[model samples]
Structure formats: structure tokens, C-alpha cells
Target: MTTPKTNRKSGFPAVHLLEEIAQLLAEGPRTSNELVAITGYTKVTCCTRLKQLEASGQAYRVVAQASVTWYAGRKPAADTAAIIPRQPTVRDYPVIGRRDMLVQAFFGAPRECRA
Candidate 1:
């Protein structure tokens, strides 16, 4: 009589896959499709891993009107403030009446009709 040989590499396959998914989420939030493309895993596999992560409290899901976004940690507050305030940029300024003024300033005033 001979005992059957086991071909197991690791005990927890789900944990291993979950760790890979968590690493990806740590980089930033992502959609399931993005995970699929990045990990080269099927959509169902990615989604299953995400659900497992969510259950384990290592990740979370945000449902929007069109799609769901997954983040790598506990769900953030709805009104969380940024750790560092952002510096204002050109785009931050209002454009209501600055376009024409800026153009005229750069190019000089349009030539006036000499009567």
C-alpha cells in the first residue's frame, strides 16, 4: 500500500492571492477591470479577491452610479480633510473675465481705427 502524494505548495491559496490584490490596492483605488488588466487575471477572479479583501477588512468598495471603485483600506469618511492643503494653481483662478484681458496684455491692445 502507498499513500497519495500531495502537490500543495502553500496552505492558503486565497490568502496568497488576496495579498497580491491588496498590494495593488495600496498603490491607489482601482476598478475590478483595472485589476484584471494589471494582474492578468479574469474578471471573476479579481472581483472574488476584492470581495475577500473587503471581508477581511484589508480593503473596501465604493459604489457609484456607473461603477465601483476599490480602495486598499478601511472606508474613508465622507468629509475627510486632506493632510496637506493644496497650493493654488493657474487653474484654480476663475476664468470668468480673464481670458480676453490676458490675451490683450500679452499681445498689446488691438489696433484702433485712425479717423
Candidate 2:
């Protein structure tokens, strides 16, 4: 039997990354670090695959603690994706406000007006 192909740098099963990750998820949702430990994959690779799974309807994510994300084998609801915030347009803000004009006039005046 041939040895399993793995990433040379990370010692992670390069060819079967997703497959390995899915099997790990079978036990339960796992934190990014947990995946890294189990598969010997880099943190970045594990997190990246987790996001891909979450996006492709194969996995979901949850907050385990403060800012800790765990990946579970499930799909998120249609509305779970974040809604993009509306960008502020030029019309949203006026170039000069009433207070700004008043302040400018009070602090600055034409040479003749200063007298």
C-alpha cells in the first residue's frame, strides 16, 4: 500500500482534506483548533474549508465562546447569510451644515467685514 498523500509543509492529508474534515465533523461540531489538531492541517486551511462547507450548505457555524467559531455538519437557513449594509452616498451628507456655516462666518470674515 502506498502512503497517503499529505501536504509537505503542514503534514496534512492534502488530497483528502475535505474528506478528513467531514469525518471529523461526524463526531460533532469542532472548533478550528480542534480540526487543526485532529488532521494536522494548518489553522488557515481548516478555517478556510469550514467556511467553504458553511457556504456550500454542507456545514454551519456557531459561537462556542466569546468569538470562538465551531463548524458543524449542517446547512444554514436561506436568511442566515448576512445582509450587506447600505453604503452612504454623496446625498447622505450635505457639504456644509448650518452649524458649520455659522462657525465659519463667526470665525472667518472678509477683511472689510472684520472692521
Candidate 3:
């Protein structure tokens, strides 16, 4: 049987594309079309790079709508079956103690809120 074509490209192609795409995602989630505009790549090339990033676990996607997928960089997974983000919760805001309490006590009340 003939071998299927792998998406790999030689000469740091994935590295260059990965960094660019990661920067774009760091700014905000972007669709493949948006990436094409920003990276000056064709739809096929952009899609290819996106797939590579997802497979490598350096990025993740969210279905923003019926037909659109927004992609963003993720902290790379140690082992890549899947990566689940740690959801924010009330527990994350547990009260602080010690020096903060002393400062607050000395202040005798919080300062006025800024505009």
C-alpha cells in the first residue's frame, strides 16, 4: 500500500508557523479565515498549521457557533489524550491572611475606589 501524505513540512515550517499562530491566539482566539488574513497564508495552509498545533497539544479549539471554530494556544499537555482547562471557581478566591490583614488593619478602611 502507498503511504499517506503526512502534514509535516521540512526546514522549520511548523516552528515558524506555530509561533506565529500562537502569538495570534495569545492576542485572542481566531478562526482559520482570520489566521489566513493575519498570516498571509492560503486557507489550506492555515488549516494545516492549525491541525498540527492541535495534534501537538499546543492549541485548542472552541466551537463558537454552528459552523465556526475559534482556536487559541494552550499550555502544552504532558501527555496528550486531551487537555481540560482548570475552570475558575469561588474556591480560587479564598481569603488571604497575615501581612494583608496587617496592612488592611493599619489602613483603618479601604481607600476610595478609582474611576
Candidate with top lDDT is: 1
Ranking by lDDT: 1, 2, 3
Q: How many backbone clashes does candidate 1 have?
A: 0
Report the C-alpha lDDT of model 2 over 1-115, residue by residue, as the tens digit.
8888787655756767986787778777777787888777778988888777777767777775666555555555545545555666656565442445687689874334344
By the TM-score metric, which is better: model 2 or model 3? 2
35-88 per-residue lDDT for model 1 (tens digits): 877766568977998998888778989999999999988766622544556776
Please give the lDDT score at residue 87 for candidate 1. Answer: 75
Steric clash pairs (candidate 3): none
lDDT of 3 by residue, 14-113 (tens): 3477677877877887788888776765688778878888887667776656655655656435446365567666556554443467877887656555
For candidate 3, the per-residue lDDT at 114 reads: 75
lDDT score, candidate 2, position 68: 57
lDDT of each: 0.75, 0.70, 0.67
Deviating ranges (above 4 Å) for candidate 1: 1-15, 77-115
Give the C-alpha miss distance for residue 39 in model 1, angstroms.
Answer: 0.7
RMSD of 3: 16.7
For candidate 2, the per-residue lDDT at 29 reads 75
Q: After superposition, how far is residue 25 of candidate 2 from its true place, in Å?
A: 0.7
